[model samples]
Target: MKELINKYYQNHSLIYKVLLFLITTAVIVYFFPKGGKFKYNLQKGKPWQYENLYAPFDFSIQKSPEELNAEKEEIEKSKQLFFLVKEEVKAEVIESYNKKVDFILKDSLALKMNKARLKNFGEKFINNVYKVGFLNKADNSKIQSNQLITLRLGNEASDILSDNLFTTDELVSSIQQYFTNSSYESLENNFTSLFFEILEPNVFYDEELTNRALEEELKNRSFTKGFVAENERIISKGDMVDASKYEILDSLKKEYDTQLWSKSSYNWIVVGYTILVALVLVMLFLFLKKYRLEIFHNNTKLTFILFNIVLFVFLVTIVQKYFVGYLYVVPIIILPIVLKAFFDARLGLFTHVLTVLLLGFIVPNSFEFVFLQIIAGMVTILTVSELHRRANLFVSILKITLIYTVAYLAFSIIQNGSEQKIQWVYFGMFALNGVLSFLSLFLILIYEKSFGLVSDVSLLELSDTNSTLLRELNEKAPGTFQHSMQVANLAEASANEIGANAMLVRAGALYHDIGKMLNPMYFTENQTTSVSPHHDLSPTDSAKIIRDHVIKGIEMAKKNGLPDRLIDFIRTHHGTNTIYYFYKMQSELTPDQVNIEDFKYPGPIPFSKETAILMMCDSCEAASKSLKTPTALLIDELVEKVINTQMSQGQFMNSDITFKEIQTIKKVIKKKLHNIYHLRIEYPE
Candidate 1:
């Protein structure tokens, strides 16, 4: 299984690329919402751009959420509540009242007649109370109107009661009237006092029945305000889309969108989507191939770039399905920021544009969406060019957010001719997007570690001399470390002149000679005294020791988890060139035949301008130190000799460095070296 996996990854052939393309296409298509997109883009309050729009079929104009909510509020405010009369509750109250009357009769012997008389009075009092009806405090508050409400006693019988039916004043008055007709008028006050304690609401609000009725009524309320018949001209071109016109146009758009998926064939939609995605991907690949061929050839880099694009596009699509209004919160500018951090600005902008174009299909108002994203992407590329500094990212995100808001506001005004139509939440989302874009700083580090990729931020960290490896290099081989620093300066200058990656070359030059730390004294730079270690070894052995540093450097770099890009500097600095000193010594001793392979440094020559420039810098710097009484002329001679020798040996043939760039590099080296080795004259006093 391991071998199969290895074989699968070992060859990046046409089959592999085809498989990648197919899988990418499948993943993207799976995330897409199941619907056909409306062809014409329209917005509320905007002037119509296309010709006259007509309804293709009879469709209802659906109410907006705001309108539906308003209708619901009205229903809640005016809807009547039902109350069910519990006859058993009246019976329970009357039994309790009779028991209370018995207690009262026991206490008031002077005024009471027989128990039957008191019980009859209590029953009469309870009957009068039930006639008025009872409602809870909450239900009583809901009836604002003074009109009567109906109370249902049974399926066939009911009564209408005033809104003030259950007031305390009415309860006492009814009790007084019941006793006033009796002989126990004196007992009326005592009985009325007893009735207050036992009184409870028999008319309970039937919430379930009331809610059921309300729902039925709400269902009768039409969700559609009106209808447009088939072949009706909705709006003409150049017509201002007012609220009513916008509503009709919006209704037509929604109906057309729905019918596009349901009534029309979806097979063609799938085909169209597939073709569009393929074309965009193909364009991205071709752009990389023509301009950034190195990234194109590198499968990891290409996958990283494509993965970011697809991931963001998928996220945008999902957000469109749910939070369509806050689409600006997706932070599409993160694509350009991440790409520009890892790669160049040109590739970043191109990838961003293609990603935006794909998203345009899924979003409403394609022109505005595409316009804002493209402009924000441009701002990201131009402002966030250097992501090493935290301040740069902050400033860049602020500018990107400002551009998004301004562009969106401008589009909103063009549509509505007023700022009131703008959605403030979208502006807040743009600000949140700026804050969220800061996450890419950490994401940059994650991608660097995951994909074996490097960014300027990582390069800046690696350039610190206090790092463990660099400090170790200083402790073991201070002279060699100093030489590496000098080479780094030269290489960075030359790279900048030639438009190569200056940061990468600078980092590479610093760690290029780390292998020499393994045996510092053997190298001449770290030798403290006149006594040389090479004296004890033969010329072939000494050359072998020198050549092994490159191999050792690579091994140590791997052990320490250094990236391959930096290791390339260690591998190619010597460019298979001979170690001339030891080789000449061996030739003088033998004078016969010596194998060239033993004398040459193991190398797969420099393949980039940075590495090639480092090679020249390393050779010229090291050789220039050997010149006694160095003059400007001598430094110039040395620079030309070293670079010209490397060029003649075809060390730079594999690199993309042009002859003109090489000339520029040579001139830079001469000037820098002359400044370092300028002739000084002693003055006599």
Candidate 2:
């Protein structure tokens, strides 16, 4: 039982990996739509490639969105506007007019006119004008075409031509003619102004009632004008899918997705989703295990990758359910951009394609959506390869947006065969997608902070010599600072030649020797006077101090908050190789008492191509400074000896760097050294 527990304890990490894989698969599967996928790839312009297609169940043929929108637009144009006539307003106006006339006659200069006849004619005119109804000015501007409005007077309603109604202007004309035929032309102008001021539009636009009636009409609007019985042949093989046939196929697909499945079939559907989603995630895991073993072994990085996929799938799935129109605007392109920033383009594009394929099942028009997104993902990977460069960052974003828009445009035109028929809203979606893709920059910063991982952007920031830690290193140990800079250049060039992360290696190289600052004078490079610190110390003490630099560097780096990745270079730059000078001297004096382990630098060795390159560059750069009169040949020999010695000592055994890559790095170092020494090529005749 004890042995069994120990065995389980030893394999806990592997078990954790298995659990992570299962959880990722389950989460992705849960994001899938709980419906069966339609079996056919339906395209409107393409010929039917399958055998005679038939409806398996009875379903109404749904009208196309364009058709439904056209119907609604007709209703908007031809709907009747209802107006109510207030019968009480007529009586109110007459009483108010009589009061005004009585008061005006007592003070008027024209009191010789028959006041009773004047009041009677004005009352008669008001009844004639307010008979039909007058429209308010606000509603008049809405309808420019011929309008037939419904006028309601209490419980009675009647349809009347809008031209028959009297506007305020028409009332003026009628009043002029009435007075021309009467004996009251003396007060015509004054009464005309009074009539205009006293009268209000009795027949108002019944906006509330009109809207309710419109809603009732719209609610009764039929989405389907026809229905197809079960087993009806929809289309035959090799038949062109015209508009009518396309509508039938689309309607059938919608029914297939929405119709309730039987208990057994639903369970089967869920099982199918599980198997497919699990397979995709399995492929991702296998890819990481095979190609990116370092990341596969590190659970933090593995979780980071998995978390990104799940987060995007969740966001896109929610959008698919709630805001279906904004599906394209969900910014799926950001997946590739973020992955490329943290990892490599190849992995980014691969995982992006996988993620888009998973989403293909959720979004409608799966083929077109998957095709467009895969292309966009590839474009993202290609352009965002150098996201650390601020100039190239916007350029990449613009290129990604342009590619997505142009591709979507071309696909739309090809599918519809008419640019006018293309749904222009998708163009806005694509533009907004581009805008949202810029969020990848902020997302990267968030991931860095959350996951304790580093990206090229962070590496670039750390690479700046003016940073606090680097500035202190320069002030305290200028010689070590200069050495680190030279080593950084060499490591960067070597990394570029071997297709490693140049920025990462450069950052690693810069902070690798920070421990030398603690005891700067002990190192030969910082010794300005003719005296040496090691002269007063014994060989054992000297070796101990020299080896303590790696330990001290790691402590200082952790204290200052450097990433574990950069700290690795400080730990492994010298590997476990011995400080041979002090070791040899100690052994010569006390062969029996000298301990080899005490002389060795504590190291786990360089465990990656970047760290291995730093080790080689560090050793070669320091050794190069010792040459009294250097030549290209001697520099070449020095690089070969240093790297080969480290190689024979198994320093690069765990680094995963190949022999060819090592040879290439050596050649780069030799050439760079020759240039630094100003060695000109011997061009002989």
Candidate 3:
């Protein structure tokens, strides 16, 4: 039992990878929307390719959107709008008119005789205006004269022509017209002024009541106009889906998707979703395991990849639930852009395609959505080669947006066949998706800090020679700084030749010997004087100082907050090779007292191509500087000897560098060194 536990602990990494995939699969399944899918792909104007379709049960035929919209428009155009009558305003006007009418009339012997007639006329005119209903003149333009509006007075409501209502201006005109035909033309001004002063609008448009009435009317509108009985054949195979056939099939599909099934059936649906989602995740696992074993071995990176997939899936699910019209606005292309930034284009595109395939089950128009996202993802991987340049990302976004718009447009044209039926709103959605894709830059920064991973953009920033750490190295150890620069150039060139990470290797090379800054004169390159500090110290002490620089470098790098990837160079540049010169001196002086481990570097060795290249370049570049006079043949011999010695000592045993790549690197280093020394080819004399 103890041995079994130990065995489990021993293979924990492999076990963790298995659990990682399983957990991710389960999480994705949880995010999968619950529902049954209609087993047919519906496309208007396409032939029914399946067997004769029959209604499983009696279901209503849902009206098409166009049909429902037409009904709504007709109702909106003819609906009776409500206007609430202000009975209080009418009473106030009547009461104030009686009080103010005397002000308009003066006592005259002839006027007194007609005073009763004038008072009666004034009361009748006021009553007539209010009875006809006074409305604001500004509202007249919104409703047509013949349009019907319901006038609600107290508890009673009556529909009337909008033209029947009197405006304040019309009331004045009517008073003047009445005076012109009668004998009291001189009293026109007085009557007009008095009535106008006392009159107030007593009717207003009741938008709330109008909306309630409209809703009541709409309640009578039926969503379905017809019903198909059970066992009725909806369409025959190979029949072109005409308008009538399309509606029945669409209605059946809606009913089928929304219909509740038994628990056993729902569980089977869950099982189906699980199997499909698991299959996709397994394919992704196999891809990583076969083609990207390094990333596959790293649980953090694999989890990052899986997290992105699930994150986008959740985003798509939410959008589909609430904002289905803007489903394309989710920035599906961000997956490939982010993956390509941290990894490579092939892996980015592969993972993106699989993710999009998973989303097919959730988004509408599955084929079109998958095609558009897959194409856009491919364009993202192809166009955005360098995340270090912000301009490149912008340009890639534009290209991706263009691809999305063009692909979606083509699909629309193919399905609808006419440009008139195309939904142009999707173009705006594609543009929004592109804009959101820029969020990947911000997300990349977050991922770097959160996951402790590195990207090309970060590597590029570190490669700047004027950065804080590199600047400090230059000030304290100028020779070592210059040496690091040469090694950076050599490592970068070799990495480019072997398809390795050029930026990463260059950044690592610049900071590899930063610990030499502490004791600048102890290193031969940093020493300016002819006398050596080592001459005054014992060989054991000197060798100890040399071996301690690696440890010191790691400490300084961490204090400066450099990425762990670059710190690997500091740890493995010398690998575990012995400080042979000082060791030999110590052995000769006190052969009985020497311990071999004290003179060796504490190393984990190079574990990748970039680190292996740095190991080779650092040793070859530093060794080449020691030659009194460098020739083409001498440089070649030094390069071969340095790299061959590292190879024999098993420094590169953990790294994946090939023997051919090493030979190529040796040639590149020899050429770079020769150029540094300005060596010329010798002619046969």
Candidate 4:
């Protein structure tokens, strides 16, 4: 069941693919116009409905012939009404003048009989008869009946009477006359004059009742004004070109009928979109195949890639949607970063290219932009290609900045024909982006460490010269330090021969025997005073201490933050092989209770080429010390015997070591051992 699950994840199983397909389908479906409304609306030219319906009204200047004619007719009608009313008022005024003259004369005579003065009686009688107030004025006696009745009334009353009678009558009569006696043409002329007179008081000919009659006349002609009002509201065809002016309610209805219901080009667009999505999924599947073996044990690659792809696509889509006009170049910068974090530089370059191609399809006017992106991406990939240190990552960012700057300027010049004036600005922005990339690299490193990726750069950092644990080993167990140095040299050389990571092997060698610092005297290498600590101890006790070093090394390593790879080399270098001479001597004297297997070193054996080489080197170094004459034959025999012993004991069973690699290792070790134990020349005295 576990193997099946492993294989499923390894092959990027249908479950994950289906999940991705469903998610992508959901996203595309959600954004796709429902019921073909958008397409139907588009086909029916109803794009205006999509515009904001609540937009502010735009002010504009406009004029129309109907508007002008309606306005003129309204004004003319007002004028005609004003003139007819004026005529009727004038006739009434003439009759009232004659009657008023006769009444005034009779009242004057009656006033004289009542003992009132002639002038006072005449004024009072006129005031009573006309039912009007008299104004203060000189020559009051002139108010009597005369040939023309030259009354000495105040100008207020006279003006009021003249305006109320003549102007009001003229206005009413003119309107009525326009409707009654005049031909249509004449009536139109009168109506226009009357309308102007009433509606526009300044344009009216009658000055007598201009203030009072004009307001009333305009009120009566409101129906004509309404026609002019319609003309005022009639929107011109040019005005309808505005999207807001389009009736949204009507447009929405049409869109539902035409665009939503219509099946047209949008179906093809959806088909193309789905195919693109499938292509992305396929590409992701292919890219993940490289980790098939690794993912069998760890699904980190799958998890990381899925996370980045989803995150990147979402971010790029957002940038494309909201920031429509501006170029969103973050994908160009982020693609290399994400790939470098999840995989390596080679894969990062591939991802960069893919991102550029994908984004080009999304962004408007993306040709030159995509070209710039490609240049930047390539530079970014090159910058981080062989990064084995954090400092190298930073330096790579600087290089990336320089490359991007040059590329951006060159592209800008080619595309827009812009001068070099803003090149420094571009350089500054490029440098800023490089800084961000460096920060992103740091973040990835932190995340990788958190997840225990154990990149080569981290390994190098852990193996630095000033490593505190190594320094402690040098101080506490000088003999073990010397031993580790020798082992490091031997293991590094052997690893190099076998095309393994020589530095890693060397570093692992340096820290391999650190457990000896706990009880340094028990080991022969650290016993400088000629007193062997194990001489008084039993073989079993001595073997126990010897075996304990492997276990002890692991504890000390954990305390010092040493990685698992180093600890593995420490533990497995002596792979459950017996302390042969001691165990054999004990076997001669002891019973079956003291089993030889109990004296053996506990190990799962070397699982890697480097560890296996270290194991062979450890045994070969110890055995070589016993040889008086270190010749090629002795060194060759010792190397072969140690390797063959370990191999026969099944110590190399689980390792990737082959016979060919073992032969190479033997040759290298023989040469090194021979050099170390070479015979010194006698003095020539």
The lDDT for every candidate, in the order shown, is 0.84, 0.87, 0.86, 0.59
**Candidate number that wins on lDDT, 1 or 2:** 2
Q: Write the per-residue lDDT of candidate 1 for residues 147-207, one digit (tens) a residue.
A: 5555767874454645556656567777777667667777776777788888878877778
lDDT of 1 at 161: 45
List TM-scores for all candidates, in order.
0.77, 0.82, 0.77, 0.47
Q: Which stretches of candidate 4 lie over 4 Å from their true place?
A: 1-437, 496-499, 591-597, 647-664, 679-685
* Model 3 lDDT tens row, 1-685: 9999999999988898888778887887787777877889877678889999988999999998878989999988887788889889878987897788776567353264477687777788778877879987666665786778889998999988887888865787778766787656667777787877888888888889888878888888999989999999899899988668878888998888878443238778789988999899999989988777767888888889999999999999999989998898898888888888787778899999999999999987787788888888888888886688889889989988998888877777766667787888888888888899999999999999998888898999999999998999999999999999999999999999988888989999999999999998999998888999999999989998888889999999999898777898999999999999999999999999999998999998888889999999999998887899888889899999989999999999878788999988988898888889984699899
Native-to-model Cα distance after best TM-score fit, residue 270 in candidate 3, in Å: 2.8
Candidate 1 error regions (>4 Å): 1-11, 44-46, 102-129, 141-152, 156-162, 168-192, 321-328, 385-395, 411-417, 431-435, 466-477, 490-503, 515-556, 571-685
Candidate no. 3 TM-score: 0.77
Where does model 2 exceed 4 Å of error? 1-9, 47-51, 93-131, 134-146, 175-201, 237-244, 260-268, 385-388, 464-482, 514-556, 571-607, 622-629, 638-663, 679-685
Error (Å) of candidate 1 at residue 164 is 3.1
Ranking by TM-score: 2, 1, 3, 4
Cα error, residue 654 of model 3, in Å, equals 9.4
Candidate 4 local accuracy as lDDT? 0.59
- Which wins on TM-score, candidate 1 or candidate 2? 2
- Residue pairs with backbone overlap in model 2: none
Candidates by lDDT, descending order: 2, 3, 1, 4
